[model samples]
Target: MSDEDEGPLVKKSRIFYGSLEEKERERLSRETAGTGKLKDGVKAGIAAGNINISSGESMDLEERVSERQSEVLAEFERRRRARQITVSTDDAEVKACLRALGEPIIIFGEGPAERRERLRNILSVVGPDALKKSKKDDDKSKRSQEERQETWYHEGPNTLKEARLWLAKYSLPRAMKRLEAARAHKEIPESTRTVKQQELHKNLRNLNNFCSQIGDDRPISFCQFSPNSKMLVTASWSGLCKLWSIPDCTLVRTLRGHSTNVGAISFHPQATLSLEDSDVNMVSCAVDGSVKLWSMDSDEPVADIEGHSARVARVTWHPSGRFLGTTCYDDSWRLWDLEAQEEILHQEGHSKGVHDLHFHPDGSLAGTGGLDSFGRIWDLRTGRCVMFLEGHLKEIYSINFSPNGFNVATGSGDNTVKVWDLRRRRCIYTIPAHQNLVSSVCFQPTDGHFLVSGAYDNTAKVWTHPGWSPLKTLAGHEGKVMGVDMSPDGQLIATCSYDRTFKLWMSE
Candidate 1:
């Protein structure tokens, strides 16, 4: 009985052990499933590939974007090049090309390069059919610019163009005559020319020793040589205009009407040469706001022209000697009929006080400059501003018309002297002339080749035109040089300084 019971117990024990092993296997399978699910969740949250903590993937993305941009730029360049065209190298071809491109066919200022460029642009846009029609409009614009640049605009009464033509015709023969005379003069022996020049230089050097008589109680502002070059007219800060004998420097007569500084003194073109001394020989303007006409023989003014509300700085005689142009501190310049002594035109355009005025040799144009740092050319006959001289960085103190009448020289507070071509209507040269403000500039009347400038730096400079080179620097003035002038013969240069002296310089 004990053996049978033990056998049953052992069988039961074996079954129970087997059941425990199966339960253990099932628990291990469930744990393995949970761990695999957790691993799958972590992989989904992190990413598809290995995480690049050093930003290598970001650099790869940037490189891809850069490659795309380069392709776009290359395509743009190809399109631009496809639209480009070439212009001809020849003149006629250039003109034809311009015509075809709808640009001007004839040229006033169009150079071959400019015409070519214009043609190229036109061909690029509309092709070549527009070039012939281009000339008429281009000519009109060119003429307008020329008129504006020369400051000779005129709303003519129809006869003015005819008058201009007549004058041009008249000038051609006169210029030819002058050229013939020059050629004849050039034909003279070089030794004789040298001797004449030497003699002129001797006279100029002798002129350096002139007596300085006190003309007024205050500083003298300006002095002018009489038309005959025998007498001198001086204006002073004391508001007096005095006539004096040359070389001797003896005061002859004093014209006193202005109450402030006398800024300008201009002699009539015919005064002391063809006009009588008793006639109105000089015109003077002053800071007292008045312009006075004076006779050489009298101490009183012959006529008073009073319209300016502020100081009148400079007065210029028209080549006709029939009109007077005066610049004033009121930011306006006026043209007056001298014989009638009435204002013919009130020109107001400057932004600051007008300091200097000059009439072109032809008498058809007048230039006005002031503290506005710009200059204006006005057509005297037509009463219109034709050109504005713009470019200076500071106030312009003086303006002078070249003897050729197409060039202008201006002295400015920027310490430079600028040479402007009225024909080109642009600044052709800039002379770094002085260390301080340039007070005056004057072109020689006889020879258009030379110019003179005075500066507040206590120096006077002799300059050659066209090239605008400094020929000489005259440094003797003890104080600021106020004015400079060249003799009609181009032999001597005279400079007045604030140190109460005037010095004459000659080419050594």
Candidate 2:
């Protein structure tokens, strides 16, 4: 198509060169010439001998040369030790190590790499013994922090207090029921559990890319299956959210309200089942900094919640379905009261923008992952961060709580998925999952029997639970996969990609 006919969405392919570009080129040329002259001068000086020097002056010059050589050797040794030392890539850990060594936690104008190098140099100077001591001290500090957070309290509006009380009431019964289910599950015969797991894995091993559908003009940013597994929602960079019939991959509805790229799509917990068609069944957030509530019957949003000065990265429904959670580029996450249609809490703790959020199955806690390479678990009823997930080497893009409520899985830019044990308050396993950034992770809804991950590698993978072994790879997308989710029945997997399409995967 011609550029004129292609409309505003399509850009003409033409390069523009200006006077500033020419000036920059000229400046670079002059700098290059100066460097060449300096190198030539140094070479000439090295080639010449100091034959005019007096004996005393020659002796003093030789001593100065010896000192210069020592300085060079010392620098080489420092670099070698930096390469050998195993300082953590986590900035917080590096700062702690520095503080433990009686050095400044940070220096002005220092970046992460420089801070790590400084820590490495200090460790090399103090030796491995000091590193061991620092680790111990760091562990002590972490324990103290956790202890403080356990009793952490802050005053809030009366609405927030009421919301907290409601959350406590709502979650307590669910937690009891979950515990009961767990106990009953534990009582089951080991052989029976093994056979069920084996069957599940066998089916997952046969998973195939069943079908694909072009969903949008731009990249699909997120996809999710309805709680009933009868429909799917796909959000796109074109600022549209499309709903499709599950399994058949037929477009059902097109919701158009966001004026910019949509980043998240969240179906209410009871949507497609108990929720009425005229009621708010879905929620979406976009780059326009608006969160919109959508109903199945309308093409436009039923309600728009606006206030965020930055884009919202993810939105999720509380298990109770009365509250909503959203993570934003403002380095904060907010809790929204669906009944009042207002933000109830604005939470800030991450050092960088929050990327994704998910509530625990029991509704007592919410987990958030952020660009700061950290995941935090917050108690919904207490309004305090209870667990810090701290091992990923890069920004965390997705977080999901297992249905069993004790394990949290995080997908990160490090191309890994870390599963943390909430009971132990530590990471239990890390899956070297993708060749590129892992964009999304989801555990099967019914029982957390399996985990699915989507990545920029253009692939989605199914992993067996407990063992965390690879079950299958669903590969067909022409671009990076942005999101992955499993159906409520655990019989189907859905993935959306930057290829402007979403696909269904299932056993043949």
Candidate 3:
């Protein structure tokens, strides 16, 4: 072949010039001082280390770098696609995939899927970390969405709204009165207060010794000191109410008519002090569903309040001593007129048997607790439920309206005593007061600051209000303490237990 027609690789000098377009070759030749020998110019420049490559060479270098980057990106995408699976992939299948990827089929004591996840994580670490982070974010978002969907809300009844409003109205003034009284008590000279307390404590210490008398054949359900603190009224599960003289502990009279266990007994607010012994001095409720009123001298009940269909659990005389309130296993609490011998109102709000009842010191409101773990305060004048005591998770066996009027204490089967503030409409305090069900709670009638509670845990506890601190824990009972009562003078605490014994704890 002719040299002029030789291939580009063979005729290097000519091909170098031939590869350039005519204008580009001219520009190169001009730049190289009109030397048309492109190959010689390149050789000389290389020897001098000043070779000036054209812009086309720079463009080729960039293209090669981009191609390498694209190849790396394509490999990464392939690995990602291999790691991913559709929702149809089973856990067993995932384990198989991990095994095929040279990972453990299972970890120590872990199932196949977890092992597969561990293997997948090992592989992901070899790749970009962003992929794993994105996967975690996606999982968290899905879990959060599921939790939100599972949440629910329920609508309460209109009666609950009305009850809330009533509580606001009924408790506000009562709360104000209590706060005022507390402020007044705070103004008493500290030295004088200390002296009074010391004297009270001396009196309490003097009552350190005790004597026991067999008052009944069966267990005593309750025992209360009269308002005058001179007489003791003891009710037994054998359905007998016996009046005894205090200090001496001598039986004075036996009032008997109930054929079943007597569950509760309470004296008239003025009984034995202002009221004559010949008048109706006490009331007792029994399992036979009868509430009987008795005079101090009578062997038979002076009057019978007989409207309940099931067992009567507790009876209370209103603070005014004119009306009677009784709780029954019939799931109702009724208010009775003592002189009229008639039921004036039958309150049916609790879903379970009413266990205990108490009237507020003002005689305007009453609180009832039941086996349903709920208690309600009813405004007697308006015949409306003022507030609901709603935090207990087990049966409430006893409830007491604090003499302060706005605070109510409830003892529950959950072994807790919760103090509810009617004014704040919330539970203000909870005392894990016992190891078993708390059966009864009573605020000191005169102090309005201290409380007494008895429990199936075989103990009675004295609690102070405002902060609801436990002041004392009495642990002498051999069996469950079923009832507790505070003297009107706040000097003595009486408790009855399932062990068929009555105890007097004097707290000056």
Tell me, by TM-score, which candidate is best.
2
Q: Which tens-of-lDDT digit does each residue in 1-508 have in candidate 3?
A: 8877787787785455446445554654464443335546666886786976655362343455457557655655554543563321477766655544556666678865566556555555544354456567777999998776332324434443454354456655765787798889889999997787656445544443254566677888888889999888989988788888886788888888988899888999898779887899899999989888888877988878767889998898887676788898888888776655667667788878999888776666889998988888887766667787888999999888877667889999999999888889899899888889898888878766667789998988876555666667777878888888877777667788888878777643
Error of 2 at 471 (Å): 1.0
Q: Cα-based RMSD of the predictions, in order?
A: 22.8, 21.7, 18.8
Name the lDDT value of residue 61 in candidate 1. Answer: 38
Clashes found in each candidate (C-alpha, N, C closer than 3 A) = 15, 0, 0
Of the candidates numbered 1 and 3, which has the greater TM-score value? 3
Q: Rate the local accuracy (lDDT) of all candidates.
A: 0.73, 0.88, 0.76
- lDDT tens digits, residue span 454-503, model 2: 99999999888898999899999999999998888988899999999999
CA deviation > 4 Å runs, candidate 2:
1-154
Task: Give the Å error, residue 86, model 2.
Answer: 32
**Would you list the clashing residue pairs of candidate 2?**
none
- Highest lDDT, which number? 2
